[model samples]
Target: MAEELRIRSNGDLASALEDYLAEWSGRSGIAVEIWALPGQAVSRRVAQAVYATVVEALANVERHSHARLVSVAVTTGKAGLRMTVSDDGAGFAVDEAAPNAARGLTAMRAHFAGVGGTLTVNSVPGGGTTVTGVVRAG
Candidate 1:
């Protein structure tokens, strides 16, 4: 059962995650937005990061945002990989961006930094929140 769920194909990662997230988000009433470029030659860690970060971001949206809409965008280029999760939620404060601000986000940042990447947290009083991370794998 679990073996069947394990991903052996590369391009299927995004769709798998999308399908899984679709059900989960539907249950939780989250409007999920996703964008993927074609011809993406995915590797294991790349897919893993995508899953991890999306899960983490959605969890945050569910717990903190109270956002009616959530947008997730992923783009890969010769420079590096970029993932942005934005939500129109009630934002909070993170005075000093450290490894301990928000437990989940702290972990997310660590995940990015672990692979020579960086995560930036941006929020507005009423506008929205956007979490952007870049992982250098290429």
Candidate 2:
């Protein structure tokens, strides 16, 4: 990921993410369906934040979700940049104070906050998990 980011600095974010997802899917043997990605370029800070959040979200999915499929979406509009990573896996109780889960969530939130964005996570024991982030347009 560091190499990819270095090579893609200030380049096409969508393309870079697509490449990374493809590689990740192949290695993890987990299917990833990218629903959307912004076509235009975004600031380096926003791009890095979004990419890092996605990476963290997928890492959690691989480590805990026990999911067969994951879906990702990112878009830029008047409201700003929005991203969502959803997994069809064995979701856990969101209210439970699990140490590892808390740490991962905190890291994800920090990544977004660094870019002046906000992150939200939603999950149900029997359902799935969704990590949503939004960065309002400046």
Candidate 3:
């Protein structure tokens, strides 16, 4: 990721994410459906946070979800930056999973919080998992 950022001068978040996702999906064998990506440039701090969060979210999906497909979306609006990583996999009980038990979730939340954003995770047994992050506009 660092290499990618450096190559793009650390401003093209969309391109960095695209390359990352393409490589990740190829290796994980999980089909990725990109729903949206910001057309405009985002702040470097916000971009890094979002990128790290997305990486962690996908890592969780690969490690635990057993998902065949994952959908990712990122957009910027009056609410600031919003991102969602949803997977059609074996979802676990959110309440049962302690914060300590799932360090990845904690890390993801921290990524967003570092940028004054909030993270939400929703999942149910046999259903699926959705990780959402929102950073409010200043």
Q: Please count the clashing residue pairs in each candidate, in the order shown.
A: 0, 0, 0
Model 3 clash pairs are none
Instruction: Give per-model TM-scores.
Output: 0.82, 0.90, 0.90
In candidate 3, residue 100 scores what lDDT? 48
lDDT of each: 0.72, 0.86, 0.86
The candidates, ranked best first by TM-score, are 2, 3, 1
RMSD (Cα, Å) of candidate 3?
2.2
Q: Write the per-residue lDDT of candidate 2 for residues 1-138, one digit (tens) a residue.
A: 573354276557798789889988999999999999976678877888888888889999999999999999999998899999999999977774553456778988998899898998899886999999999764
lDDT of 1 by residue, 1-138 (tens): 232244456545657666766876888798887765313655666666656766787888888888998887777777667888899999777566344465788777876776778888887766777899887654
Please give, for residues 3-65, the per-residue lDDT of candidate 3 as tens digits.
425325557888888988999999999999999987777888888888888888999999999
Q: Which runs in model 2 stand beyond 4 Å of their true positions?
A: 1-7, 96-101
Please give the distance, in angstroms, between residue 65's alpha carbon in candidate 3 and its true position after superposition: 0.8
Model 1: ten consecutive residues of lowest lDDT: 1-10
